[model samples]
Target chain A: MTTSRRQHTLEVLVENEPGVLARVAGLFSRRAFNIETLNVGPTEDSSISKMVIGVAVEGHSLEQVIAQLDKLVSVISIKDVTGKVKEVHDTQPDYQN
Target chain B: MAHIPTANGTAMTGATSLVKSLEAADVEVMFGLPGGAILPAYDPIFDSSIRHILVRHEQGAGHAATGYAQVTGRAGVCIATSGPGATNLVTPLMDAAMDSVPLIAITGQVPSAAIGTDAFQEADIRGITMPFTKHNYLVTDPDQIPGVIAEAFHIATTGRPGPVLVDVAKDALQKMTTFNWPTSIKLAGYNPKTTPDAQAITDAAALIAQSSKPVFYVGGGVIKANAHKELRQLVELLGAPVVTTLMARGAFPDSHPLHMGMPGMHGTVAAVTALQKADLLITLGARFDDRVTGKLSTFAPNAKILHADIDPAEIGKNRHADVAVVADVKETISALIPALKAALAKNQPDLSAWLRQMNSLKSTYPLGFDQPEDGSLSPQHVIQRIGQISGTDTIFTAGVGQHQMWASQFISYEHPRTWLNSGGAGTMGYGVPAAMGAKVGAPDATVWAIDGDGCFQMTNQELVTCALNNIPIKVAIINNESLGMVRQWQTLFYEGRYSNTNLESKRVPNFPMLAESMGCVGLSCERPEDLDKTIEKAMSINDQPVVVDFRVHRDAMVWPMVAAGTSNDEIMIARATAPDWDSQEL
Candidate 1:
């Protein structure tokens, strides 16, 4: 049976400090996983930053990548925005790129 | 407190505090070499309770630390200076990361003022070791030394253990400050989930109770979590077989009736076939490595995988798990056993027929090798002899290649941490230094290193370190006169054209002589009859290291081999006749 790869958007909250992004990116690179797009921005809490990363992963690898992202000391929390964002965009008729 | 210089609250140098921090971590020994940039850190070492081993190469120090960690189930510490000294440690750090060994590597960087400048002996070691380490820090202030050191140990030892690097500036070590050890840590994002989800455990238990052809695919995490007892209990409760991976060699005792030997590449035929035919796979603490799941698509095609691991990343990385439990391995396994027992009490699955099938496969294709009737020594015979003589408690360390695979197959491990090899990285030259480290960590255990001619030549310099430290570890080099594994592959796949794989005695450095020059008692056994006596003589000597070189047949290959990218079902058993050799005389 073939398992199709699906696009996943993960929003990770992390400590705003030097090398934190490198730490997260390093893990993905080492595991040989690909990142489709990534964006980092300041969150409500100035001490913590938000990183949104999008990637195509099979069902199993998605769970693994989420688990690995949780292990980083700088990562505060993670939320899967893949299905939620798609739903919100589908409801809004004027929603554009 | 009495040793402090201050009248009211004593102040101390960062170097002194660093040593105190290591003491707080309950470190009894450290493996390292002294250097200029790390000179300040060395000053306090003279007064500390920790014993520092002087290694010939920094790589030796690194692997030695990894060995210590593997044996003691604690974080092993190693030290080095900036530039080349720190760079030499990269390989072991990478190896430890891949294998998830707990290690703490401390390096002395250039002075803070000289860090950015092109100063002598300057290197951005933090940057160099970043990708490989689980966590790392560069201490600029002496006040941060105690806290950083504390966190380094905490990070190194906890949750899916791996190496942690701490680079201290030379000035930071020399600067004097009030010593206030941080009693508490507040790393907001660093907590590990140790308790698995209750529903997931239940789901797994139900799956275990429902399936007849169930197999426990155990990995290194089981050993790391010290959950062997729980694993054994679960296996008994479910009445299923277990196939321990290379990393999980001793997690399940090989002598057990239901134990299928190691699975995947180089694994026994029964173990490989059992995994392929299994309906339920309870994978504990192991990532689905490419080695274990050859041609991943065809691996365990009929099985619904239940992966229980501390690292969530491992669960679905290679194969999709129907039930995923992320928690401490001991906790997860302990929870699983009771649930499975309870589930089985209601309606037990009849696994007797499945067990019979597995046993039949086991008996039909048992791990075997033929003894050369021509009086030529076989490496397998030599290793099996060592295993028989040393008994079950002897810890075996091996370098990569044919000798490593032979050592794994021949040596039967009954306890955890008895087999130490570079499994994931497949590193050559890991045997000697790792054996030295294992001997140092477990002083009372009989530590033996089984190495190949090609692998032994990689890090034999550590024999001097072993001799100097009075670590009496025995090393048996299965000298086949060439890179046996690669040659075997060349013979099978490359049309028998051996290129640069040969390490014949006439061309290469003499192993026995090299061992002798390094202050070891070097013994060679070319005749099969002399193997037992030579090993006994080597084992009797306790004052220094002993090296026994067993020159076996150059072409003897590791049997029951699973060619890379092939299904485990098609494992190649021993060939009836030897293949053709090139110009080299047999």
Candidate 2:
């Protein structure tokens, strides 16, 4: 079987608690998911934190990564922001023109 | 369920709140060892109603908790101090994680201020056990104790079960707190999907109806979900063969006609062959583990996979599933049964050819070991005899090795939860403590730990815990006088150059004498003629734990071998003999 790797971005909203970031990072490290970039900040709701993670992974492996992330109790929600970014770019009016 | 003490907003220490929270969880028994940091919690435990088994080691406590949880289908609880006490629990926690056993481990941390200051007996247990646990918490506040305990139990026992650790600060336990048991737990992202997708179930049914050679690949999750009856029903309806994995020994009755036995390395020939040649694999609650799949690319190459498990991560983690159903195994089977029946009424696949082929393989290459030419007792015989005499009602726990394999292959488990072992972790020294916990869980049932000489020596100190606590678990030491499985590998791949594999058990640490010193009834059997009487004597001892040292042949090896990272096609039925797959027609 041939597996083609792709870059996917995920938006994860988690509880603003101690070790929450460590839990997410630990999961990626242990499962060996390649993280391209990760950014975490407090959400409008200070109790919740949003993490934007860009990962280089294969099709099935990305699904596994999302599923594993979802299993964490601290994680509130996860959205695949990869396609959404493309949708936004496609719908946007050309500024240069 | 036992009476739970009312909180009533009484002012109490966090230690008292912790003990009260345990009572509220309906935890009847717990296994633990107390030390410096955890001394505060032990005081409340001493006054509490919960029966705490003071194990010699924290590892024993963790394994014992696992044993209790596996047998009783409740969250088993274990307690320990920081540093080494908590670190010792790392193995059992990982073992529980692999097997999906519900375990709640409570550890005492150094004071909150001293957490990162390298205080005496301090360890970052929560950070240490993150990967090994389903979830974990580090409680610094005294008020978080009750809530954390409750949530820990809830998370540990729910969905796909696993170990959860709660590390309470020493000051947190000692500080004054008012306890309030939460009426309900709410974790936004933690809800497990119990009901499977109707479309997925329908798709699986259609596939099953169309398949000619399908096998029900069952796993420990079936037993965990208490879905064995549903599994039996589905298998019978399809008239297909079933192969239980090592972790799922008693998930399906061994006596069932469709049962092809366990599959994987050291698995039955028929079971392994069935998986190798199957057209469709109806995987239920079982991940396609590397051990089971052999070489991943070649495993069931022709088979379309129907993977159903409560854990979504496991669905396509190993093999791609043609029809993936993520839900509780019980619910998945319940929904699939009706859909399958509807599909079968329209077009029933003929499996006569497949059944004939399976039966032929089963009869032709039945599981058996040759009598030792050296006249030493056969370990297989000793384990088989122990199973036969003890009967199917007995709960059998085994340490990892050739003995564990023999126990799985030789024993006929008719019911779920009858067999417990360290399947995923393959942790040795599991048998004795696990059996003690099992016996404690089911006082009336006969519990036996089938251990090897190498394994028995690791946690045999727990036999004292058993003796003192009235557990009365029987232990059968399959003393091969060597690391049997590793030695077998050396014999096979390393040209018999034994390197440190020999335990020299014949010289040091006489097992029976050790057992006697630990306040257990000790029995020794060196000859086949005396095996029955010695086992019977061990069985007859109801007031104390019994350890029987059976001196068996050291040269025996587990057969039906699939070398690690090799294809199942290369499975050897015996020494230098591979079954001719071409000759068997389906």
Candidate 3:
């Protein structure tokens, strides 16, 4: 199976804490996955923060990464903005079906 | 997900899930020193698979992590407590930042309430690290923990990769929060294009084809980007000679015909001559650091430079590039390779004249030093002999300042990550522990930590770690009885004011006693005559880490010294070009 590479923009809700950034990227780097862009900032509530991670993942790797991310302790939400790309070659038509 | 490891699950105590989250990130190692504010981090550290190697000093933690990253090709992680602890990590972070190493430094901060209140050991860590780090965050709440860590690691090892700082406040670690790792990030400002621009590649190729005397001045950027294969292809395509900066040691195979060795301060005479004669200079992944440029105007004077790097800030930071292509080194080289192939029409031109001049310089000077035969210790002779015995596979790590420069100039590091040092950060006490870490990474390989007296003393306490772990590392101490580089400056510029730079009192300190206290063996090299046997014995002892203290000349200085703030070209060779020592072999 060919690994489909796509850049996805994710806006995540997180609990801002010490060493969280290191914990987070240490996640991806440890997996040896590639993150293309990443920026983080606080939201209205000081307790909550927003993280945007632009990572390149193969179709196979995306499912594994997302499943692992869903299991994090501080993550509130994860939204994929990769649809921002023009209807590129159908990535994982199996997911839609 | 109650799989979250928590102590008591109380509202006052934050979850160890953050550490668990780090495990998901695959952080197998953490080099840090513990302190009061960071207790929560330690609580979970023991539970996670992530091994925490306690460095003797906080500064050493950063160096250890940097050394780890340098050899393993991974983002190095370091942690420290609030205030002084955090401050200790700054030099190493700056080194990682300067050299574009993928480094993440996490420090504990006084709780938000204690901040700005002159609380015990409280300092504005984020503020101090702002300029040095590629990005930094003062994590405020438990919810923000996972995302911030993800971003920190991402920012550090990406694009023009550098160090990233994450200062965690005390309260945040005490709060309870659910963890969710980030699967992706959306950083608009950080767009790193891996593919080179077609037009610029074509333009660069055109510049190369027309120039009669072309040279490749490669640097560390190429190594960081893992572009060795592409760089070699580009060099071969251009059929021109290549000269690298100290930081760009392994960008090209040192054995290649076109490779002219390193240039700049203490640079090879051949490489320096080649840089002076080249008409077209193709620089890759290197900043024109002053040490590498000597007199800037006179440097590559005849050559028009084509500078390429991922960081745009470095495009014209030191010397103005005739043409600056701001792109990743690998991308730029890949593009250039194709362009050159497409535009290839001529075979290799005759570089016989240039080669002859370089060959003559190599044979005449040949970077040799001899101590009074059968008299005492010579660091040069020790290092040279070590190089001969260790062969190329045995990796070498050096502490800053003069010893590092000397190692870079003299050692032929054939392996890509074989030579590790505090290049940009120039941390003195980095060698011992970094060598310790290198040995840990590759257990079977012989690891040598080459250090100066100034550097060894800084983190020499780590000698105990080697003893405890029984990590057999051979250390060659080039003890000069002073902060030799600073003293060198004092001798040349400061009119020998002789302020606090001297370490004469400790010149003959009982290093073996110090090592014995830590359960490690130490050997002293007092006679320049007994240098070879001392080195051989040090390298042979596999029982514990060994220290070979070579009592080098106290007044010794690294030649080709460039005065600060001067152009890279304005260098002082041999302290005013007068023959201080005869060129003849003693």
Query: Which is the leading candidate under lDDT?
Result: 2
Worst 10 residues of 3 chain B by lDDT: B1-10
Docking class of 1: medium
Clashes of each: 0, 0, 56
lDDT of 3 by residue, B1-586 (tens): 1233342233323436557556655677888888988878888887778888887787778877887788777788889999999999888888887778788888888888888899999988886775567778887687777777878777777787778888888888888776666667765335565566777787787777767777788888888888889887787766677887777786676767677777876676557667777787788988877667766666777788788877665665566677778788888987888777766665445555655655565556455454545554555656667777777888899888777877876677676778887766666787998888777667788899999888888788887877777678888888878888888888889898988988872545767667667877878877755767777787789889888777776665676555665644444456675222334221
Model 1 TM-score (2 dp): 0.93
Q: If you superpose only chain B onto the true chain B, what TM-score does each candidate give?
A: 0.96, 0.99, 0.90
How well does candidate 3 reproduce the true complex, by DockQ? 0.02
Best by TM-score: 2
lDDT per model vs. reference: 0.87, 0.92, 0.74
Candidate 2 structure quality by residue, lDDT tens digits, A1-97? 2336688999999999999999999999998888888999988999999999988895447789899999999999999998786687688857845
lDDT of 1 by residue, A1-97 (tens): 2436688899899999877888888878876777878999998889999998987784346777887778777788999998776677688756564
Model 1, residue pairs in steric clash: none
For B399-487, candidate 1 gives per-residue lDDT tens digits of 99999998889889999999999998888999999999999999999999998888888898899999888998999999888888999
Error of 2 at B125 (Å): 0.4
Clashing pairs in 2: none
Q: How much is the lDDT of residue B160 in candidate 2?
A: 98
Residue B131 displacement (Å), model 3: 1.2
Q: Give candidate 1 regions above 4 Å deviation.
A: A1-9, A43-46, A54-61, A82-97, B1-9, B576-586
